[model samples]
Target: MNAPRTPLLEMRGIDKAFGGVPALRQSRLCVGRGEVHALIGQNGAGKSTLIKILTGAYARDAGTIVFDGKGVDFKVPIAAQRAGLSTIYQELNLVPQRSVAENIFLGREPTRFGLIDWRHVEVESARILAGFGMSVDVSRPLRSCNTATQQMTAIARAVSMRAKLVIMDEPTSSLDETEVSTLFGVIRKLKADGVSVVFVSHRLDELYAVCDRITVMRDGQTVAEREMAGFPKLDLVAAMLGKELSVLQGTRRAGPDASMPEVLGVQHLRSGTRVKDASVTVRRGEIVGLGGLLGSGRTELARAVFGADAVDAGQIRIKGKLVKLDEPADAIARGVAFLSEDRKTEGIIADLSIRENLCLVLSPRLARLGIVDNRKQHEITEEFIRKLGIRCAGPDQPIRELSGGNQQKVLLARWLAAGIDLLLLDEPTRGIDVGAKAEILELIRGLADSQGLSVLIIASELEELVAASDRVAVLRDGHTVAELTGDDINESAVMAAMANGTANAAAPAQAGIQEVAHG
Candidate 1:
């Protein structure tokens, strides 16, 4: 019998820090040849830090990296790439001004007689892209392509490198259902070709779908490592969050207060093809969830209510008064704040400091005679940072530098600072870790109970929807199919309603009720 084969990559006792603050301690990982391994943790839990150390983007203060059975310490990203390691970050590193072909073969274009070969670049780039089932013009600027195309282009570039190990950070964040399926196929092909992958994503379903082994990290330490098959989802979440299942449930309200009045009401709402007809009501001090499948108009309905998107035909009532919310400003003036799902593009002003981003909407109010009071701005930022337990250097720190969890807290704090009465949250805890999700959900429940903040939220995770929502309105095919309240607000009931597109006829009337939705 042959001797046991060694892992393709191994890191042991890795330690790293920033500004004297430890980000990783005793973090270790082992990846076998041709294995798809998962690295999961909460934001700021050392996932990114460990990956950076592996890719040579950051130097580890202490540890050993053994790749292909040899110890090595690469000084820079290029050096690591040359050593058969490639990383495709969540943030695209390609140049917007360059064409797809130029990006794919950047720094390594084929040569013909000591000169550049544009023809080879185009043909080879197309061949690589075709492997991902993408058929866009290779000559076009990468910026002109859709988000899915751009992501596929990035993956093509990584595959073309022909590295031994590839690290993908949230690679499916931009892709749709079909595109995600295509990506899975590509990943399978890569496995067949004997390339190992370090897959990182917050989405749990995707993890179970692709990864063979799981490594859970929490608070800069490796907590658990197990085969993905035997590991339960609850156990994985518990390890990543460092909490028990009971404690992880967080604070869920005992349904809405009976005395509380409806703060937000939409009747027969219509917005483009995505939202044909939708109706729901959220009472003060209540969290209402929009439950639906992909492309079921949950996001569109939320946007229309917040006035971020156009309302083709609908009636909106705020506090029992009909209002026309034509624009976001109109909604804001009426005490509505929306947390966008696309955090990078629509939620945060990445270039600004945390102080500026937090107080952006409230700045005008702080201004006296066109001069905003700087002291008041800092005061608000400090207050919310403290209130939300935001871990940061200071309010002046660039918001882009914070982890996903802290950034999300800042966005929620932004609305809290603006004195908004109603909150519309789209995928509030999408990319953050399980611990962050717990914190955010608990915070929302606290707001609804203490501040009487009415909330209408969209969540892709059925467990999250069932746990956080006081009442869940199920929608399918752009129509309000059923509503689940109190005892009926469970995963099975929500999934049934969404799939069947109708209320349960046998149960009590309160068990399932369809909203007043019309086409």
Candidate 2:
């Protein structure tokens, strides 16, 4: 037999830690030349950490990396890019204010007589985009185009760099089905051109459609590696969740009780372009989840309900009475609270102390004679800090100093302190550790069960929604297409609704639960 083929990229015995908290432990990955590989895991499973190390964003405490049969170390992101490696993050990193051609050729514009060659830059950028079947004006600002076009532009920049290895993180999160197909075609072309790609996404079908192999990570370790062909989807989910297949195949939570009072009623809700028509109801002591792809109006509906977005036409009922929600203050006064998806920007006041952030919503009610009651604020903060099990130095600690999970808990406490009757959570458990996710889910369930609070949760993770929700509403093209309940809430059923606008009745049971695909 001939000597074993050397991998184009090999990472072995990698170890990383943050403030004595280990993020990766002996994680190993090997990618063959020109192959499309997938890296998958839960929110805090060391996936981002590992990618950061590879791209030189973070220094690994210990590891060995071999690229193209040569031992190499990248000291910075630019150094990695110089070494023929490129990365496209989940969030588009291009400058929106810059022109498409300028963004593509940024920092490397051709110079003539020590001056930039604008004509060459525009021509080159247009040529590159055209190669990807994009025909937008190269001189226009990147933000002028739609999200799909911007995404393709980002990819075009990476491809223009002549990179041998490209890494994509949640690249399709903002793309529609047609745009996703276009992106896949580009990936196939990249593979054909002998460029290796490392794909990361939560969507399973996208992986099976494009990737040749997959590596699963759990709890900071590489759990399994297998070829994409014949690999079971349920097995992949179970591995990421760190649970057995049998456990996942067990019974789901029961549906909502009809006898409970309606806590919120939204009819014909329309907001902006994303939410054209949405109708939903949440009974007291029930968790209703909103499920759909990106731009499916899930977040828009939540914002409209919370009065953050202007409703063009709709009727909202709170406690069986018609209510006008013209602003967030209106919603809050009516015992409604909203936890925005972007916690860092929308949820928390990073510079403020935990006590301050928690008491922000309650400050109006807690004030006396225009002078805030500091003593009362402290008491409320201390109670929630203890009740939520938030790990922090003290109530006076800066919110920015805590971990993602702890910061999220602090945001939740902000709403809970107001004693709201209804909670609107958008991507509540996102960007946090798995342990923290379980704790937050449990806490939400406990509040609904004991305090009789109704929750409307919007999550991109179908399995998470199915597990935590009593009923799931699937939205497509700004419409509530289906509502899954009872035995119909499962990954397959949700995926079917999302993909075909209806669930397939004949899909086999991969994890014991049977699913139906209709509204």
Candidate 3:
């Protein structure tokens, strides 16, 4: 007789709502021992809501949760943690100012004679980190180390707590290639030790490379579940997009018009530790791409151009006129808009309605007699909601309640409505699913083509940038090392530029070059 299979964690018919609005509807997932399972969906697709419910950050209205073969319901995060579940969010929730040992052993520290034992804490912390092949000084402040080291520390803390299931949300977003490999090695070690893991990320390549199984979510429900070997990356993308695989392959188009005039110019720019000697130009009716590995200065370059970061030395000209954008307001005044990389902390106003979020940037222009015009605001919000196909119940819906992709569209609409001359986008499609990503890319292309808009896009996915950009600017250690276009574009060339800042050959970027229709 075949051995009976048993799930270590199983959640069935999970239902959750916020203020009478349904966030998750009948969502279901299962995890087995020693397997790395990935949960994926677009923002607002209920991935976070579902995880929060599982971790006891939010109580589910209806559902069944069985962990380690017993029915369970947790009232708080601590309760869930105590039951052998641990979650590491995208944002490092660790205390940066505190020592590594302190952050690792937070809340529950070793006690001797009713007082915390500092020496035991450090000793245990060092031993835990060492298991992950790390030997850093545990006494140092967590902020002193880079993101990779911080990530390792977080993982060590989770494992130290005897967690049975470790849920890592976008754990590799800020990690470099080497760091990612190291993390994968640690994951393998955990798997060997019989600890299950739930990996969540927008990077599909990483998912296929590491996860043993995949679960796709859409509109707050689990749509498909398949073993890793049985699924293709493109197929998984189609499932997340809620579209047939054949349709996605059929719709392929290049970027903006080549004949448009230059709208924004950057020359020899430098900002702080990162962002060095970089130069880029964006033409009206074109989408220029900034491509590089993590920490290669993609976000830094965007920040410098948008004046979010102070540029030590550089020249910026808008429409052939010099402008000193020392602050974000100055950049906006110059008709420049920036969509930040991190959406939670940098983009949305959690408490505002969809209308307010959409009109936040264009308030002054939409105002009259020192009074806000509600009708005009409604019209603007409705137009964008229809135009971008944002799936919200109404314009009055809370901005925080909308899905990630819809929120991004609202941000894009904010800039588009402001009559801006230049748009700076940083990882604009970071956490969104396949379908939304395609729609956003198409929207960008159409805007640049039909509206004569100028856009600078920073994206980590090589294929995405190559597919949608007029030119790819490769950065290495805060400097612009290479810019590839017609006859100099491909994965090999981009990677070559990224690793060494120079390559022997470059392939022509024929696909992204704008078509010319001469009379």
Candidate 4:
């Protein structure tokens, strides 16, 4: 037999922890040279941890990393980059104020004898981007470009380094269909050039389309690793969840009480291509979870219902009364509150104090004849601070100083204190830890039960959604295709509904679902 070929990179028996708490236990990865490898897992499956260790962003507590036929321990990220390893992050790490050419060849530009060659930089950058089907003015500021262009620029920078392996984290999260296709083309080109790629994404279609092999992670461990050819998507999902679908049976619960009044309803809600057509209904004191894959328009539906985005054509009914929502103020006046998925950008004001942020919505009501009512504000802040169990030094502290979990609590308090009838929460428990996620979901559930707050939420975690939601509405290709109830609220059913883009034959969406037919 011939000698075995050495892999491009390998991390065996890796272990890591944060503050003595284990984050990775024997996590491992192996990527072959010139192969496109996919690393996939849920929100907290230690995928990021493993990648960080490989990149030298974090020190591995225990493990041997063999890269390019040498055992190495990278101390800093730059050190890893110099060793023919590069990373392209989801949010992008390039400076928007700089030119595209400057960003692509930021530090290592094509210089001409003790002087910067601006023309060469621009021409070379444009030439490289043309390979990816991107035609743009390279000298222009990066901010002028769209998100997809910015993302591609980041990838171009990685490729220009002549790296042996590239780690792409959620690279397609912001790209459109055409842009994603272009990205796949570039990846293929790299593979043909003998470069390896570690593709990390939650989208199954992209993984199955491009990746040669797969490694599934669950709870800080590598649960499965195999070739991608015949692996079924459903089986992959089950593996990622660490659930044996054949053995586990989901429990059925009673449906919502029909006597309860309808809180919110959307009929044929449409907002551009993001939300083609969506129809959903939420009753008082009920939590309805929105389920869909990436680009499924779940967030768009939530935004349109809350009046944050302009609805091109649709009808919204609150408490059986039709209302026109021209702006968020109109929705707020109608007792509707929205907690955006991006809390740092849309929800919270960095410089504002906790008390100020909490009382921002109720500020107008707390005012008297253009004169502020400071006393009532103070009392309301104190009461909510204690009642919501918000962990902070004091109510006057900056909201940014607290942990992610605490910041979420403050945002929740802001909405709850408004006495809103409907709460449109998009990914409320995101970017927080396991304990905090449980705490936030439990809090929402408690409020729904005790105060009769109707909630419509979108969660990436299927288990959490199944546990917390009274009903789950499945959206496919920007349309509300099915609604799961009682017995069908489990993960498998949700996945099937999302994939097949229809309701189970046994139970379909009540009505108005068949009106907006999908082509």
Candidate 5:
């Protein structure tokens, strides 16, 4: 037998902790040269922490990292890059106003006679992009190109660095189908050139399409590792969830009753290019989920309904009465609440105390004669903190000091304090630990069941949508394509509707449910 090939990169016995809580424990990963390795887990499953350790963004408490047959410690990201490893994060870090050529050669531009060579930069950038089957003008500003082109330019920058290993984190999260195909082609080219790749994505199909080996993480540990060819999708999901397939299959609950009063309705909703002619309904005490790919108008529809975005054309009915929401104040005045996807910027007021953040939306109602009631605010904050199980030092603790899950809870409490009838949540469980996710999901179910709250939720996670939604509205290219309910509200069926833009007729639907035709 031939001699065994050495691994391109190896990480073993990794341990990381934050605030006395372990994020990773004895996590291990080994990647071979010229192979596409997939790292998969739910939010806060240590994937990000591990990658940060590898890239020197976060120092590991305990671990041994071996790369290119040598032991090395990278003190910073630049050090990692200089050591022949590069990482492309979900958010592209390139300057938007700079030309593509300038972005590619940002810090390391070629010089001629003590000056930067613009022509050489453009020629080299074009050559690098052409290698990836991209022909965009390198002289144009980066922001002039679409999201896909900008992402490709980021990859080109990484490749041009002569990196032996490239780590891509959620690279396709914002790309369309065709754009994703283009990215896959580039990955194949990189593999052929003996470059190792570490791919991280929430999309299972993309992992199945491009990865050679797979590693699954759960609860801050390496749970499973296997070849991608024969691995079952259900098995992978189960591994990530730390549950058996049978347990997951049995967790599908029944949908809510259709006879309930229609609490919210949208007819022919159109907002900009992303949301076009979309329609949906939420019944009293029911949860409706919006399901689609990243650019498929789910967020746009939510924003339109919440009046965060201007509606070009649409009719919104609240409790059988037509209403026009010209601004967010109108929606809030009508007892509507929205929880944005980006919790850090849009949801929480980090500088304020937890009590202050919780009382923000209800400030007007809680005040008397232009004066604030500090005692009443404290009482209300304490009540919500106990009810929502928000872990914090006290009501006076800054919201920024709390964990992601606790911060989300405070935001939820803000709306609850306002006594809203309908809540719009976008990726409520995103970027939180699994235990926290379960708690939040349970709280949502309780709100619908006990408090008669109608909710419209937008979630990228298919399982969350299927489990929590009484009916799921599928959107494609900004149009509501189908509405799945009962037995039809499943992972396979939803994936079919998203991929093909058509509902599966064979799947059984609940009574009184109708398909939403695209306009």
Candidate 6:
């Protein structure tokens, strides 16, 4: 047999720093031709730094990078793109108002005599999408399509650049099972065409399913590299977390319990295709999970309950009294707070200081005669910063200055400081580091136990839902198909529910017991 193909791109001894703080130290990655290489790490593991270095968003302090047999240094993102490298970020960078064809061939659309060639753009986009087994209308605005379609469009755009190496950051985070499998097919196609892919995701299952090799990073250093064939999932987790598998698996030191009073109850809730006929009970002193595939209506259920969306038909009761929630303020006034999924869009006012962002929701309580109490705001902000371990330069620091994880913590603090009785968290720990995830989980648990607070958490990571939830309610096709509790709330059970809407009857009863805990 011929020798194995050489790596299409290689980076050795890459080092990087942010604001004088070392973020990545000597991390190494090699992406072979026609292979999927995964990068795994906890939050703050320097994953972002490494990607930035590769994409030319940030210059590496020290490294030897060779792409397609040529040693090179990229000083800007454009240079990397021109060199056949394309990155699809976790945040889904696309102009929603633009058509699919426009987004795919944005800057370099077909032109005739200095004027744009719209007809050619659509034909090219259609042909490209057809290769991926998609026939979506390329002329329609991107936002009109479901999130999965939008993601597919992004992938198509990347490949249209003739990218030899595609960096997919959390590509499947927002995709359903079917959509995810479809994406995998596309990845395989890319590989068959001799394209190298860098896959980064918090979901280990996806990594195991697609990656040929795994590179583990921790605290800004490449810790281990292992082939996928014999790699144990637990070992992968251990590597990313910097802990042994045995040490990581166990009951939480303290977790939520059953038999809690229902702080908020919804019977037969419906909101768009995202949420349909969903019923859930969040009890005081417990963290219940809304588990499902992407578009299973987990976030939609949260939004409906929090009044972010109109409940087409349902009964919502708080403290045993039926209530009307016409808007966010109505929910807030009823002691229910929702932390939205996208923090930058819905959670933070970037121009505001950390203190202001924390107090934005609670300002009414601190206000006297319509005059804001700056002194009280400062005190509360200081208290939360210390309590939540939010890293910031000071209270005066703009909220935008913090990292993604830190910005998320501030959003959590915003709701926690309000001392709401019921919290609807949509992917509360999303995009955060492992340590931050654990910390946030612990904080939510403690708040439930100590303050009799109730929480309904929606997270895409199934392991997180399994670990943090006292009970789990799974949705499928916008309906609550299964509920698990106690012994039934495991990865298998949640997966089954999401896949086929099947569950052991004992699961719901176990969850019923926990509901009494808070009552």
Q: Count the backbone clashes (under 3 Å) in each candidate.
A: 0, 0, 8, 0, 0, 16
Q: Summarize candidate 4's per-residue lDDT along 1-519 as a digit string, tens digits.
A: 111145899888999999998899998899989989999987678999999999999999998999999999999999899999999998789999999999999999777998999998889899889988789899889999988788878878888888999999988766667777778888999899899999997666677778888998888998888888666666676677665545332442343587899999899988865787899999998999898865678888887877788898889998898988878888988899999989999999989999899999999999899876878887988998888888888888999998888899999999988999999998898888889998998888888888889999898778877888889998876788788887767877876666455544223222222211231
Candidate 6 on 108-138: residue-level lDDT in tens? 7989899899999999999999999988999
lDDT order, best first, reads 5, 4, 2, 1, 3, 6
TM-score to true structure, per model:
0.65, 0.73, 0.63, 0.76, 0.73, 0.64
Top model number, TM-score: 4
For model 2, state the Cα shift of residue 207 in Å: 1.9
Model 5 lDDT, full chain set: 0.84
The TM-score measured for candidate 5 stands at: 0.73
Error of 5 at 376 (Å): 8.1
Runs with alpha carbons beyond 4 Å of true place in candidate 1: 1-5, 132-137, 246-256, 265-281, 287-317, 320-328, 337-420, 423-519
Q: What is the lDDT of candidate 6?
A: 0.80
Question: Which is superior by lDDT, 1 or 3?
Answer: 1
Q: Candidate 3 vs. truth: CA RMSD? A: 9.5
Which candidate tops lDDT?
A: 5
Error of 2 at 418 (Å): 3.5
Instruction: Name the better of 1 and 5 by TM-score.
Output: 5
Q: What tens digits encode model 2's per-residue C-alpha lDDT throughout 1-519?
A: 111144689888899999999999999787878889998886678999999999899999898998878888788999999888999998989999999999988888899999999999999998888888878898999889888888888888888898889999988766766778888888888899889999997666677788888888877888888887666665565566555533332134564578999999988887886777789999999999898765568899999888999998888899899988889999999999999999999989899999999999999888889999999999999999999999999999999999998998999899989889999999999889899998888888888888888999998766678888988888865778688887777766666565445655344423222121111
Return the lDDT, model 5, position 24: 98
lDDT of candidate 3 at residue 238, scale 0 to 100: 51
Clashing residue pairs in candidate 1 (N, C-alpha, C atoms within 3 angstroms)? none
Residue pairs clashing in model 2 are: none
- Flag the better candidate by lDDT, 2 or 5: 5
lDDT of 3 at 183: 89
Cα lDDT for residue 208, candidate 2: 75
